[model samples]
Target: KYRNLLLPMHMAIRCHEYLRHTAAAQITYKITRSRSIQVELGKAESFRETLKATQGPCNTSKPSMLDFVNKAKWDAWKSLGSVSQEEARQQYVDLISSLVGTEAPAVAAQPTGSTKGFQTLLVSTEDNITTIRLNRPEKKNAITVEMYNELIEALDLAGKDDSVITVITGSGDYYCSGNDLNNFTKIPEGGVEKLAKESGELLRRYVKVYIDFPKPLIGVINGPAVGVSVTLLGLFDVVYATEKATFHTPFSQLGQSPEGCSSYLFPKIMGAAKASEMLLFNKKLTAAQACEVGLVTEVFPESSFQSEVWTRLKAYAKLPRNSLALSKQLIRVVEKEKLHAVNDAEVERLVERWLSDECMQAIMSFFQAKSKL
Candidate 1:
């Protein structure tokens, strides 16, 4: 479904570019599969309008009636009558700029300094704090393979930077919905076994960064978090959440086991039975519940969550950086080796799970159910 919508829009953009009579206007559209359905439709309409205005009209001689894809594109293009090319160009630029939002540059090729062309995350530093934000809000900040790599790199940079505090959060409503299921479908040329191995390796390194992070690692969970996103809180120094936030690890539902050192840390933090309820039985915990279980440091009222968390963080950042770093390192030193072992074990187990029939069936069922919706 996503592919069907994307291919036509991509081709339409290319066609528009090809038909351009002037070099004054050029569009560099960054296509993302994570776009919401409404957003996708809105962009499609805009694209059609832009194409019609700039190109004058769909080539009636081309896109034969039997060519459904091209025909649909033709119909869409025909529906929007042509306008002045200059007007269309301005409208297209304005629309793209608006969609890009203030967080990113309007032109896709524009560089985001220090972030080094990160596609899935927003990394920024301020007031002695380095923030790594999961930016895919339309998909509840789901972590894709690209996101995982970007996160690892971001954390590594943050660890070495002058920032006294490193924070992780999400853009928009969700803190994170956890791994994008679509990540599994993108198997490399070596097949599932190879993909599993490489993914497991990546997961290991991702978790290890958190375990060995030098600065104070904070999680600002503004909304619901799931799977590895929730599990990773075990390695964070502090996890501040909004009152409306929730933490969930639905590993069993996906026919997968625990990761991010959760298998070892969850029981240690919340007690075996409570952890079992979450890790084994897929029980979701509210912000209060999570705090009580030691997964969250504290919960703030949604009305003031941001102001309150940042106020404290800024104050904390004012303290002697080395002292704070040393203190955190001292606290984590004992568990560093333990977390490493747990991470390796979990990754190996996950690799096996990824290649299993049960996991595949569960993922297929999930997609089937979603398609029906």
Candidate 2:
């Protein structure tokens, strides 16, 4: 009884302070402190430290450091997902507030120098280019609901603010791997129906935003693009990559269908046969190969990729902003309704896939594979 009272009282006070100061005061702190969960937390903290250091840009060799960091982060998050979310709300409120502090730091004072409270992205504007980076390299830059909201916010800013162009990229080794499985695992008690409802709503919002983005959107594929990320490349005005970059669509592999309006876009962009190879067989495309196939605009040398890409983009951004916007709009205006319909259909099908036995089996098989069962 004392434990319950103490936690809530402490949290209420702190949360009041938090709510007063910042909006990202939302805290999700549910877990059982089992040995395995603690171990996962330790690993997650370690990866986060490394991720903090990898804020802006860093050089890389053959197998880049980002790749290593991404894998470690994925492993950590995967382990963390094993944690159950059945604890009392008051306990969580108190524990989270105590650990992370009462007041969430203001965006202007973020350690990453980002002017936003993004859990899975690093957002900043320079020379009219709003660069929204996928910050969760630990999970191969997967998209979660929070991350989706952040991305939309960034785009909204780009449309309203003085930013001339917006660029999306990933940290560590990936541009964006796809939707994070961790998001689906959070509602264990609600089962497949819960997963479908939450994910379908989030994904539909994401697809709508992507389809109707008002500003010129560029994708900087720093290393690899996979799943929804790969499909999203079809929507970007331009996609640039490094020599070490790769592209893959694993919809069928995951017992899911194409997303990001790729069901319509892929066939047109890469031809019917190649699209089948990618969607069905999970064919991975190297940077040069992706360039040849029309998915990637250019593949720069790994050493100078970042500098070259940003320099070119900054130069292009300096071009008349209205001209750039109008030109892009002209190119894509015809397909707006088509893409929207496809997005709606895909979301419907995706919900069905989520509830299907095949998807459940595939998810179970994945766990077995990870646990060596």
Candidate 3:
């Protein structure tokens, strides 16, 4: 009888603790109504926290004030559902529109001084050029989540910075090896779908950023440009790769499809057959081969690679930045651009294939083989 009587009290205390912890966590609101509601809810939470900290165990049958507030707030929210539904939708649309209309925040504006989300990409302005470098040579400058975010963030910042006439490279040894496979295993449940969506969005944003950018986006591929690195090369206005440099896309080897609209861009740069061969066979190309395919503008000797890249960029920088940017836009004007469609189709297909038994078995087999090795 005593234990049964204590059960409700124990349950209420646990509930109180849970709600207190939940309130302590940072919350995000997507719409104006949600923000307003969250603010009100936060105030109620403060009251509940205060009560929880101060109030002694009640001997009475009456409910506590904190419990009363929680139930009241929840009931009020439920009552307002019909009234808030349309307003909530409109606020969301407005928020999205506002975001789309405003210029993206500059990398320089960030207090963190990081690009995308990487702490490794060091950004510096030299003369009229913005130099961005991947600082993680220890990992062969392999693209991690932070690195990927930083790349896009840096590009976005450069795009908005009018003083940046040309963006130059500043990484040692390797341009980028590929996406970090170790990071791949850490992805959460439904991460693949989330990544696909995010990748598509990032690709679209990058394309617009590059196309409408006031300055030339030059790429100095100092070494290997593999996976996302190679696809990103297609986004640049001009690319200079060292003789020692190589480019590759190993999507097929990983049981995934091409990304960053490589499907459309590669075929446009190289011939359709060559693009198909590279993507399907997971082929690696020398800098000279990349140049031959019209994917790269020039290949310099490894000894003078840095100097050659800067020399070409300096020549480009001598031209009015707007003129160079306009020329790039003109050159690509006739190219049948279908990046978004291709990205969506590829992602849809990839998700379907990723869920397939064949792909699962292949991935499992590869991991097993790797473990043995």
Candidate 4:
């Protein structure tokens, strides 16, 4: 039995080396012992063999330059047996580049019978209210690159179409869940700055649309309004959330920072202490709590959420469009000028925090535990 002890000791070293390239891999090694040590070692060996086979000359297809860069980075990580601070920086740059380069593809515009023209957002105009449902429910109403572009278009149309007075809701029961995580893996290996710029541009554009739109923007939060989904609500004129709705920001949890100018808007809307609690502490709020904090205007039963929202929208619609638009503009103007600077500062601070060892460790730990579960 003592003779077999050397085998486990050897397995541990092999497992450690194998996991060296991944940020989350070390957490697995830490959480599990002996048997896992052997298993991880075997998996590492398998991975090495698979990688070798894939790179062999007989495989006619060439690996893309970005793919090769990632592979080289991973190999270097394995050879070093640990990621240094410098290596972590390079990895962040690579990861961000990839995220921005391969932003989610656009959806084809659909022809709608409504006079608003073709749009990705499904619009239903009843009386003075326009309900624009985010049509991609299969993906849980997750926002894609194309959806962002289309959202701007929809807002423009809503502004121009006099028949539509109040813009009620866009997404379905789920609302919008921010960028898809699956796409996060495919971001290119360079151009991190450009990527950040583009992402910021899209978000800024959306904020402008929300703030400058001529009528009230009411959000109907039916489920989890996560990441950007949660932040976007800050731009809404009023929000009606179901009792089932929950809001959370997983920026620190996801190895990223708060985006969509929430940092500026949240503090303005909810005050410094409350905003800090939500953004810094990553607090998740229930619909009732959100209402109390002024993030949500009211909470309604999930069973009748749609009907209730429509009732509210119709009430808003009854107001003179010009008067409603003017009131909205005045409120926005009072809060204006400060939001842009605050948003920029917040993102800069968040980016720094995201790059810190503490945040990195937290993110890696969360992912590792999540993977195991």
Pick the TM-score winner.
1
Per-residue lDDT for 230 in model 1? 95
The Cα local distance difference test for each model comes to 0.83, 0.72, 0.61, 0.63
Model 4 TM-score on a 0 to 1 scale: 0.61
- Tens digits of per-residue lDDT, candidate 4, 118-165, equal 345687666767667776667777777777788888877877766446
Question: For model 3, what is the alpha-carbon lDDT of residue 194?
Answer: 66
Clash-forming residue pairs, model 4: 98-187, 98-188, 99-187, 134-170
lDDT for predicted candidate 2 compared with the true structure: 0.72
lDDT tens string, model 2, 199-317?
88878888788888878899999987888888888988899999999898877777888888888888898899888899888999999998988988999999999999989998988
Query: Which scores higher on lDDT, 2 or 3?
Result: 2
lDDT of 3: 0.61
Clash pairs for candidate 1? none
The C-alpha TM-scores of every prediction are: 0.69, 0.68, 0.61, 0.61
Q: Which clashing pairs does model 3 show?
A: 115-150, 116-149, 116-150, 117-149, 117-150
Instruction: Show where candidate 4 strays beyond 4 Å.
Output: 1-120, 168-172, 188-190, 346-373
The alpha-carbon deviation from the true structure for residue 324 of candidate 3, after best TM-score superposition, in angstroms, is 2.3
Indicate the worst ten consecutive residues by lDDT in candidate 3: 24-33
**How many clashing residue pairs appear in each of the predictions shown?**
0, 2, 5, 4
